[model samples]
Target: MEEEIRVEFTKNGFDFDEEEVILKKCLSFCINYKLSASDIVSSWDVYSLNRGLELTVRSSHMGAFLEQLQNEQLNKVREKESGLHLYSNDVAMILDGEYEEVKEDMLDTPTSKPASANKQPSDSTGKISGSKFSSGKPQESVTPFGQRKSKFAVQSSLNENHIKQIVKVEDHTNSEDDIIKRVRPNQKCTMRIMSSQPKPGCRFMYDRIDDKFNFLENRIKKQAISYVSAGICDEPSDPSIASQKSIFAVGMICCEEEGRLKEKPVLLQSSVEHSGGQRVRLDFQKLNQFSVFPGQVVGVEGLNPSGHCLIASKIIDYVPLSVDSSDDHPSKRQAMDQNLQMTNLSLDVPELSLIVAAGPFTTSDNLFFEPLNELLAYARRKQPQLLVLLGPFIDSDHPELKKGYMNCTFDELFQLEILGKLRDYVEYMGSAVHVILIPSIRDANHDFIFPQPAFDIHPADFNHQIHSTPNPGTFCANEVKVACCNVDILKHLSAEEIFRNPQGGSKHRMTNLAKHVINQCSFYPLYPPAEDVPLDYSLAHEALHILSVPDILILPSDLAQFVKVLSLEARNEGERQIKCICVNPGRLARGEGGGFFAEINYKGNPDSSSASIIRI
Candidate 1:
């Protein structure tokens, strides 16, 4: 069998001269599992090997053998791509792969050369020669939305073009020195816990059915009335009142039954309680283009002659932004002026830099927080005025945690492993660097509820530099109102969303997901939250609402990280559309390796602001 496997591998262009032992092991395992040597060899190629192999064999031994082969193949790719060596046993487990036991050690060491050292320098046009951070130089100013620019191509050296541009902007004013002098080294900023907490005498319980129903009704009314006033839809009427002829009706889309998402009948419930508060079955066979998720308040034009079914001819999702306005609209200009004034009054300088990262701080293989440490080191180097870190600080789903393999309690592990490192970080960076910590539902050491309380850590020795906020937290930094939520809403929405026209346009799915969040004006707007999320409907009324559109919305998700400028038009005409920067700074750790974070230099305007997604 080994001989046959060798012959098949040779025919398939596999070079196993230096891996005879591994080749033999693979052959024996394949034979034992009744896997065809020819079939296995056919799946082997230069491209497949370089990209990494994912083969399923019958047993654990076969999995280990395949992992070894994958490691060798990945090494070949790495060597060809960067002339770097991947030592044996330096296997990184594919986070989304089938095998759970395979752990890959991160090969990038502290002594490794910086990414910028290999690159040639470029001119002062904010471009870097031989840099892979971006495909091309970013515009001298911000590019308009819909242009797909690379998000994660940051240079290792501090002298990159972004730094140069910021320095040039700073050089035009003589206020830098004065601003630095005004900011005391160890000053602590106050952090307000935005989400409502259950008081001492209140009973803790899940949302009642009535409360949940009322919440959805309120949301539908607010959105339906906005559409009517905007002239997008006629005055709202009960769906049951519509005749067989074409008519317009405003209602909320929902499934007929709960916990049944696939191939289930969809119903449209009218906004008005009068006319018996009717629900009409929706028929979508005629609509040309549409995307609808449960709990969406939409305007539909169709015929409901029988008062039982509405055959929808057109679906009108509320327009997120008006295309009529330019980047320099008069209302926008006025708002910018106001922001500048507020910024000047709030701080010593008009500009502020911020670093944002979300956690599962430790890698999958072990409890060592190499990624978190590297992030803090980078933060210290940048010395941003504010650092925002979102959680699952003590991730509840970690392999070690799930297996119950630990020497101490969950709280002890949190204090020693999570907070200890943070305490040291703030102490080293000094009090001028404000640290904002937001909790998550998956955090083991904290409350498991959705509208969670802030971490109650009172270190007598350290100053109030470390600020803890609730799960869906909000705060102000240098006049910028920042709102952040740690739930993976993108994944939740994507899984449950039904798009009638999947290939409709050039708009990215992520952009549409963000638009839904902003238009709905709620943190977790999905009616029936994902099972993993612990949502409390009572507190959700006050806690989940976005009081006003925030300047920046930080929604960390399991989806691909993105930094986008979302422009939302106001309901009133002639008023400027609200513009927001939405960022999902991915997780800090993916499996057993470092991931990415974001940095922003806000100068009171989205166009003038500069931001980047950098790998740890």
Candidate 2:
């Protein structure tokens, strides 16, 4: 079947009014598609538009009304015209510049004189000579109202010497007939204002060097306006033009004026005004001593714009102020006497107790460096979860020391120093303490003359008593587990025969050794069953025992290293699941570093993943 050629409604040919309406609607439609009508041009033939087509304007303003209308209906018009598409280029730069020049020429003429009366000699002939705002030469200028000016004036205003050169955009049609194709060529159209004088909430920061405020004012009125409007807002009329270049970058938000708050700091536009990379406004609390404030005119130092917002490392505040009170009064902080006793070492964690046993590491000479009282006093306030020291043992057999002639026990020799520091550590740890003791080989040696008890597992007694017997152990007044062993130091001696079961006289010594053995077994995790592991054999086992006794454990790195090794060993032996944590020794030495422990429950089936380590 043949389809008759159909014309929906031509209105006896091209009705510019209807076409104009359709075009405006089309441009608005394009905006929804994220396309700007001013940046493109639409062309169509009257022969094609049969079926109705829709068009949308980018912005609802009348200044862009023509362009917006054309843009909106362009696609539909093209579809009706057999899919013919129009094109548009950003002509803002060209049209804007020329329009400014035209405006300037009209302004410079004064109300008494017409713009034409002040025209240059060459302007009437299109060879304009220099004028007030131009190079004294003619420059081409055109306005949407069909106004014209010499090119010489535009060239002069845009000359190399101009500090702030104006940028312009021009929109040209192939023929004047094309303009009339959609509307009356001579008919003036009303413009719709989208925004004027910018929204009130718009704020700006001033640049000191430019001495100009960055205002968001609407100076652009017409899209097709020409560049020659320079005379309208010349350097003199707009005094800031000479010192300014462009509008402030778009990211800035409007806020209260500068110098409004004594504590509020002015920040540079380029500075990292946000912390933690969040868009939230930067606060005074987040600013360090070197932080810059808002509203303060500053220059860029360092900047990163990759994340959510820009981050600036350096900012130069032209008028710097001193905000640090500490600098003005340094002596306000009190000074403590050097000889102050460190008897109280209390930590602030009221919910938990602490038991720390000192060792050879505690000495009178190093009391200053090992300020137990100060460290513990601080800790008591902090109220650490728990603190425990295995034992306090001093070496009495050093070659240079003559403690042998004085017949002083290792503990008695360093008792004052050890006790004083212990008291401090305890004071800081508070009343909630559960201290345990592990006698060292050096602390229990008896010049190799005392028979090593058979059950006496103390390693230093090599030639003494023997019989493969396990001895009782000693405990502190708190009744916590106490076991003395020479696992490290005794490994160097050959006390095989003497290490066997031997006679022991007192019931207290026997009772102590017995208690140590029983506690050792009870404290160890009995995973996979303790088949052949000796009762007082491994230091790792001893550490595990201490860890099992309390909710929290505090130990030095060296001791921590032992615990880590033991945990690994248990995992390797397929005996039990153990977790380990490692920390730097420096933090431990200062008494600020200790491992924080927590337990996690898993519900899903487990996967095979290796343990990971992270440093903070």
**Residues 1-616 of candidate 2: C-alpha lDDT, one tens digit per residue:** 0000011112111123344555554455445444333222211211111111112122233344445345556644544654322111112222436645654564474657545345333221121223312222212122111121221121111012211211111023323354343342221211111112111222222223222211111011110011112121221111111222321111112123432121232222221222211121222232232312122222222323332222333322211111111112323312211111121123321122222323333222111213233334433432333333332234332211221211223333334434444554544333443223333323322111111122222223221211121111222222112222222211111000011111131111222222222222222222111222222221221132221221122232112111111121231232333222211111112121121111111111011111111110
The list of candidate 1 runs beyond 4 A from truth reads 1-164, 167-193, 197-203, 228-234, 244-248, 259-262, 275-277, 284-287, 313-350, 461-463, 500-507, 569-573
Which predicted model would earn the best lDDT? 1
Residue ranges of candidate 2 with Cα displaced over 4 Å:
1-358, 363-378, 397-400, 403-414, 424-430, 444-486, 489-616
Predicted candidate 1 versus true structure: per-residue lDDT over 1-616, tens digit per residue? 7777776555333445335665667676576445666545533432232233322222334355566556655655644655322121122222224222221221234466666435322211112113211223233222221122433456222224656687576565435564564354633444444554533223446679888777777766766655654567676667776585788777777888884232367888876453455788998889766777777778888888887888999887663333211225557746865775475467454356788899888776556555676688777656678889998887776666554433334665566556777788777777667788888877776667776666777655564777777668788876677888889877676656666443323235565677777666677778778886777777676667665667788999876777777766575567666778788888887765667788887776565677777876
Candidate 2 clash figure, as a count: 123
- Candidate topping TM-score: 1
For model 2, the local distance difference test gives 0.24
Alpha-carbon deviation at 55 in model 2, angstroms: 78
TM-score of 2: 0.21
- Estimate the TM-score for candidate 1: 0.65
The models' CA-based lDDT, in order, is 0.63, 0.24
TM-score of every model versus the real structure: 0.65, 0.21
